[model samples]
Target: MSTRRKPQMHSSERARLDPFIVATGDASPRDQQDLMERPFFSLAKAKRVTPILYKAGYVQVEVYAVPEHGLATIWDADVLIWAASQIVEAENEGLRTSRFLRFTPYQMLSAIGRQTGSRDYKLLKGALTRLQATVIHTTIRNGENWRRHQFSWINEWEECVTRDGRVEGMEFVLPDWFYRGVIDRSLVLAIDRSYFKLTGGIERWLYRVARKHAGRQPSGWTFDIPHLHAKSGSQARVSDFALDIRRIAARQPLPGYRLDIEREGRRELLRIRPVKLSTESVGGTVGTLGTSGAGGIGTSGAAPSGLRAQDTQLTLWPETLIPGLNLESNLDSNFDVGPEDGGKPAPDGAASRSDTGRSEPVSPDDTRTREAQP
Candidate 1:
């Protein structure tokens, strides 16, 4: 006679961890635009072990990508956007938000406009892995001493699964650096929905650049091709980089910005201008600038009573803008308008001429200005 003893369940198997909970409500994700200024991630899909060291006078950023995990890409930024938007929305609603967020893969994928298929789910997991693996060492927030602070994009993450081995949701903790930026409010901005559709990496990067630098300003910002190349931390040759910029300019794929290529002497420059607002809105009371003074574009002339110029004549990385950083000397040479073109004043209200002794706009199609709403 076989006596079957009652099976005793192991304590570990008996204990069921409670799933993380999130407040039931709408999600409003926002991304800090300041991040676009630095090259914290790789633009390519290929594995990148080469560390990127970017130096412009006192401003220095060092990025190290793990060989096995590769560097985070612009696409991976969607995760941050989702996180930021959710946090912001929660804060606005007086709801609680935490670094450890509980969300199903479908929720995240759908929010970011990614397909919720199994393959896409796998890709989402890979993106999280890369974000956690890629390390960034910078002096961005650190003061004059140049004490390097190292941190990954994501601190830690875990997947919640059901008894059937089906993924129920995921929880990830954001690094302090990113979390602080998002809560600051001033560092965040509202981006266009069309931003997700940009296919090319450079085009996406360029859109961020435009949003960060140009914003809703009409005057926009100008960057020398060489300087932009160096700041981008791209492995491509300068010529190739210039070609890509030209292509992007031709397409005008960026939502709120109008791109123009002009020659300043032998130097090629990319001008990013914001699309004008509608006449009806322009007539209304003056609208506030969307970015902090430290990171906003300057205005030119006195705008209509309620309207103001979005452009400014100041340089991007001036010491005044980023205290303890001295970029004037390093960038002066690159941005210097050659003496050859100094005497010739560009046509009034027309495109400015470059030092290359050629004052004409590169693409006629870019000359027509378009209107966009923020």
Candidate 2:
């Protein structure tokens, strides 16, 4: 007693699947704008979420689409699988398009626990449980009629669950459209640990911003942050990176917003000050609520050429000091490889350290004591 309609595809129509691409080293100019406007991308139009997160010197980017409405775990998985399909399809197309093609594996593992809140890794895998795709080849007959080629290909993929080491890796073929999108040169803003602490749901928010402002450069933007901590053992405070931004924005319109510091009084204001924020810090906060109140303060900078680099640290309470603070990391204890095959992960085996494990955050209690210690 099932009531599901079968999916149908036309024979003559050229199959158009979602195109996915990945570019490393420098961000492309075309793609660079996407990174700057990352805070405004829309999930409704793309039916997917493209997230970019950085650790140390590396920046990772991923894109996936959801076909359902309402927030459900099932829908999350569906989108992931859909994106994986497009990645695979795009890769196959590359073999024909170029003589020497190259691609990077999509690190879906970093995205899984991140995309799904509450560490529900199983749900992510479940959504893609029964995914399938068809590869069709076609030919032209005598210039008048187009005849279907005799070859047809179908492939099935499964979620690679690794818990101890590295997560499962997927090789993505860079399609022309997707390739062009990602190849645009951009300034890879480096991020630090503090950036992660201040932002939640940051990855998703950044995807939207980048998508919407794909082509247009901002006039100027500001980092109007309140409760920004300093590394120099002073009271936390609010300050804008306007000075730094202005330096970056030689003469264009700024592209950021203002943040109001709560908690009352000029004394409190004096206690809390703003330190100049960086792209990594800004990007980290996209999907997350900031260290302070409800909405954080953002600033708009006058348009300028090449931003100048500055070194200033915001001193917020460490994660351990914050009571009941819900911090998420790329690592988690629940991660596991598919149906244990042996004791250790195989060199060529499915169980890799990256897949089986995740990053751990500092305990709030531990942080509290350290700050107060001595």
Q: Which one wins on TM-score?
A: 1
By TM-score, how accurate is candidate 1? 0.67
Candidate 2's displacement at residue 366, Å, is: 45
Candidate 2 residue-wise lDDT, 1-374, digit = tens: 22222112132111122112222222111122222222112212112322212211111122222233111121222232223223233333341111112121222322211332323334333323211121212221101232222211113222222354222322222222222222211211112222222222222232222222211222211111221112111121224332322222332111222222222343222111122333433432222111111112122111111112111111121223222311221112112222111122233222111111311121121111111100
| Residue 363, candidate 2: C-alpha displacement in angstroms | 46
Worst 10 residues of 2 by lDDT: 365-374
Query: Candidate 1, which segments miss by more than 4 Å at Cα?
Result: 1-29, 144-146, 276-374
Candidate 1 has an lDDT of: 0.56
- C-alpha root-mean-square deviation, candidate 2: 23.7
**How well is each residue in 1-374 modelled by candidate 1, as lDDT tens digits?**
22222212223211122112343344543456547656776665456678889854334578887787677776777777777777677556554344545456655666655655665666777788878888888655444343566888887776655555556656677766676666655566666655655665677678777776566646666788877887678888999999999998987777667999988688788999878522121111211111100001112111111002112221211223222322342232123222211223323433422211223211222233323323
